[model samples]
Target: MYGVFPYNNVMATTVSRTSQKTARIDIRLTSEQRELIERAAALTGSTLTQWTAQQLMEAAQRDIETRARLALESEAFDAFQAALEEPLPDEAQQLLARSPQWA
Candidate 1:
């Protein structure tokens, strides 16, 4: 008597050794949203699979950029209205505050 395994050979698979990179993710979407994706994929002359892959890649890139933090020089930052209202150290003075040991 053999008991069934939850996952088969496919579930234990790892990334391919080829140059192409790939990832797998799980998602749940409303029927309406699913239909929208199918329609867009048809319009673009791509199979639903290819279209979904491209869209997810683009979305991941946008999310990465939007969530990243940015830094700017003091004078450049000072030109903003909020910076004008708040007192800030001079750009040159900021360099002096660093730990000498860091060098």
Candidate 2:
């Protein structure tokens, strides 16, 4: 029955320090997964809840920062700047001139 589901890693995050916890999450895992999580918790001297929260936050922040900026080589950046510096094409400028102006 246990072999029927897929297990990635130990990610137990429900057991917090306080009894008045506001949220709960239920998940299934194999013995190997459980042991791995416990070992990680022990190494960090943090409970399951703390370790999961910290790791989740770190990953999310990293993802956000990665997306916020484009990584380009120096040559690519120079080309991009050059493109911006160039004027719009003659047809595009003519079309803009014909469009109605707003007050």
Give the candidate number with the greatest TM-score.
2
- Shift of residue 44 alpha carbon in model 2, Å: 2.1
Cα lDDT of candidate 2 equals 0.79
Q: What is the lDDT of residue 52 in candidate 1?
A: 90
What Cα-based lDDT does every candidate model obtain? 0.78, 0.79
- Model 1 score (lDDT): 0.78
Clashing residue pairs in candidate 2 (N, C-alpha, C atoms within 3 angstroms)? none
Model 2: how far is 78 from its true place, Å?
0.5
Every model's TM-score: 0.45, 0.58
Local accuracy of candidate 1 as per-residue lDDT tens digits, 1-103: 7865656544544323343556667689999998999999999999988899899889999988888857668877777757668766798578677779857
Write candidate 2's Cα lDDT for 1-103 as tens digits: 3543233222222233334568766778899987898789889999987887788789999999999989889999999999999999999899888957762
Give the C-alpha miss distance for residue 40 in model 1, angstroms: 0.5
